[model samples]
Target: MTHLPRRDIIALGLMTFALFIGAGNIIFPPIIAQQAGEQIWLAAAGFLITAVGLPVITIMALSRMQGSIENISRPLGHVTSLLFTVVCYLSVGPLFATPRTATISYEIGFSSYFGTSSSHLFIYSALYFFVVAWVSLYPNKLLDSVGHILAPLKIVLLAILGLSAVIVPRELFAPAIGHYIDHPVSEGFISGYLTMDTLGALVFGIVIVQAIQSRGVSDPKLITKYAVIASLISGVGLTLLYVSLFKLGMLSHDIAPNAVNGAVILHAYVQHVFGNLGGLLLSSLIFLACMVTAIGLTCSCAEYFSQLTKISYKLLVIVLIIFSFLISNLGLTKLITVSVPVLSTIYPPSIVIIILSFFWTFWNKPQHVVIPVTIVAFIFGVIDGFKVAGFSKLLPDFIQHLPLSEQNLAWLIPSFSALIICIIIDRYND
Candidate 1:
């Protein structure tokens, strides 16, 4: 019969927002904006759909399913659900997103001061993960540590930078480049995959729920209600932040014309506008953004693995931290190179599971529809992954002719076709 007061819910929402706006969310928009140029708004719209919309929807789904990815994915059967859940945890955990948080904070925040030598990166990541470990080891304190304190600080820094981007005058936007010139919307949509928020949402589901439970709210209805409200707050925050970053990227061409990534564009813009003090502001912002996310990931990963293997949560945190540190040493550019294809392969299936879970009550035989659609999505998703990794020859020629193939969304049509067919079968059998 417990009910969380209004402020507790707001902090819970901010904690969720802080968890989602990690390295990828902060870094990707600027690069997308810079490249999409005059087509930036079109691209931004696409990015928002996946980055903001999908994650919000995901949290809503998780809310109903009692904040467990396993619950939502249970229709896939035990082994398949276990495999899928483990892969998702690893993908957004130590293997990719978590480590990227460290590498990015270093490169964007401190790399200028310390220089980008491999030794420097190693030193910084070591210190970074140490702090992540400290915070993550005590998940019970997350609402206070992250939600009330860290999230607010991160938001203030972001607000300062976002306002600067909007209010400052700069040169005209650069011309649209590459696929962005013609397929800006789809390109932006695909690029949103790079943010990995949807995957993060799956992993963070329990974390959000636990944060609410920590406040003594035990009613399932209240839990779901609070979780949905948190997601809405986070969604609105992400939308505003992304819009400003897109504008920031468009204005940065004159200052960082040859930038390779959003980090470079962000660094240059801050320096051009704020000078030495800007370095301080940028570093503070990056640290807060990356650190909160790293803590959330580390906490979530440790908690899951501990249950799966019955190991000590603290030990898992240490092991995962070390592993993530080693992988992060591969550095930012290389990590992105390695991750894009993997993400491409996995994202379609994950998206299918999340979106379809909403209609679980509608179908008597959810497995029939879920399994077939998932398989089709994963098959074409792997083909798209191969294409992204420059291994297109490994794929048959017909894949190239798939609708939306050029956008790396070649899986869409066939997946839906499979879903429709399965739905018909499910209904007829019923």
Candidate 2:
């Protein structure tokens, strides 16, 4: 396989970055900085841990693992691979993430314009999803077009937002005293993971790989080399943007004393800098940017699942878009709140698996070691998700009556114990 020219590699990297830096990212960092105050840098560092680091690692893992999502989990057998892929895609796409794109687009984009009418919002969102569904059905040209429009709009709006904060004199607010006192760095780090942009990076890595293949770089070694370079560039760009946004958020506290949420903070910034017209333009841009992301995610999920199940891609895209549209009515805040526990539960196992794959050559019996350990970790992770989401009450009385009932870290003990046992067992087997 001929190596891609350096310019082509950079272009691919930029495309990869464009794919990962979607709507949630534009809103998340500033919120973190606003809440973190003096601890903004600490929070930024933490966010990078998961947001940037994990994503780069994921790309490396994918290149190392080769093939599709199924290939990465082959050590765990076909059923487990299929199940894991389904859960990951659903979590990242329609089940939780896709609807969020629409809801957020509405909240940040149209909410100020449309006001608080549930019926109207539903009708508008239904129409938006119809467009998304249509675009997904004709993905190739549609994605390129929407992406072209949205990517630049995102950068321009954000540049204006960032510049406003940079020019304004910062009057730092007193940091809120809280239980987040002892280990701000660690708290910030974990908080960063919540962005889940890194997870998106991992899922989108396959898309990047395919893009490279389409360019005729089919050699595994060449693919891996270019993928790493591309992911590095993308990760750096995302981390810088996150940091800038967080700082902007911190500064905006002084500018918009009434700004409650990240969306409000952003709106206030635009209004302050550019007045009503600017604010309206910003909102419109956000709507288009978010719509583009939603379309990409929905199409990606539908296409992948359709391939896996041998279903018609058009039918699958329509079904998923309809489902996503129905759920999008839940509203932006609700979607973010609902997704957290699920992400917390699933993300750890996925991260661990990706990390482990880097050392595939080190494990003489990867199936014995990796498969059982991942399953055990996942079982605990699932329980932890339920506990966090307040679903433990639905468990059998006997199960809920177990020793760790009152403890939020109920999954920790069993997950670690299983991991340790698996490592020891694998050592002996080797």
Candidate 3:
């Protein structure tokens, strides 16, 4: 009988936290706080729901199935499962989130210390992805590399910064701004979409399963228990950090009232509180955070592509690194702008899948209810996708009038309503 020690559980939890806290996770909360002002708690509620709750639920759900995403979609049949898997991989991989990690480390970390020029970005990304490609070639080592070494370093730096923001006062916070005045929680929820951790969690579940197995924890129940522990650790850590960052933003809005984005807000806050050393701390934190996420995404992408194409993992790693490096040089803002439409299209359906995966057996009709609901969600998802791309402005007035449409959750009702309809039809037949 193999016994997994308490240290192993803690290490897994640490790595889980590290993997989840990427560039977007680090950047968004403060800006939301800044906008929400005195309404910080209300806004934080919404942010944590998607940012913390969604990812935790996702990991726990996947863990129960032994962390195989395909198991969740098996009821959808093979072809659809493959397509869903590909979209998930691409969204978290080179097409959007992966590239943004490098760019963010440069923008928020390096650009703060150095200057933000294209040549500097070019050199930085090449060096960054080279390291990612190197570490990712061996997936078995991530628990040690990320869990023991990198994760702690990231945790410590963020802890120091987060605490300082709490202890010091930059200025009195202003009133809730704009939409935060009327819809703090909903706006915060919508803002959490920018983090995209839920989407990443679906892919990272595989990484967690592989790492746990590498440690000889093979029983599905034990693995799921440990994964649940890891997820709780991640959820608690993320929620605390977000609360701290939101406080900082609330207090420092005067310093960056018209700043371009959250990066600028973070830079100003860190520098004001800690001085030159603060900037160095921030740089190190971003580097470590981005590096871990890059490694995780790189491995996940390489592994999935290798399985899909029958190519070697080594070859896929090299290809993904090269592609991500090229795409990352597009810079953070450009990459985000390009990603909005794609994220809009995929994220709603991804959420639906996570929810359905959990409730699949709840009604005993996974095949009948889940697939139809997902298709309807995706259809409405495409509509929201176009709205994100700015092409859906001409959409009929009725579309804008749907419940929760203002917060970009227009698909929630229709998708769930479809499931209910399916359930009713099945019940009558039974």
Task: Return the lDDT, model 3, position 201.
Answer: 94
Clashing pairs in 2: 46-189, 47-192
Candidate 2's TM-score reads: 0.86
Better of 2 and 3 by TM-score: 3
Candidate order by TM-score, highest to lowest? Answer: 1, 3, 2
- Clashes in model 3: which pairs? none
Question: Candidate 2 at 221: error in angstroms?
Answer: 2.4
Best by lDDT: 1
Give candidate 1 misplaced runs (Cα > 4 Å). Answer: 169-171
What does candidate 2's lDDT look like per residue over 288-391, in tens digits? 66666676677667768877889998999888988898888887668767887888688767766777776667767888777766776677667667776888
What would the per-residue lDDT of candidate 3 be over residues 100-165, giving only the tens digit for each residue?
989989888887556998999999999999898888998998888888888899999889978887
Per-residue alpha-carbon lDDT of candidate 1 for residues 211-321, written as tens digits (9 for 90 to 100) = 888888889999999999999999999999999998898888889996898888888888888998988998999998999998998988888889889999999999999
Span of 10 residues, lowest total lDDT, candidate 1: 167-176
For model 3, the local distance difference test gives 0.85
True lDDT of residue 389, candidate 2 = 84
Using lDDT as the yardstick, the better of models 2 and 3 is: 3
lDDT of each: 0.90, 0.72, 0.85
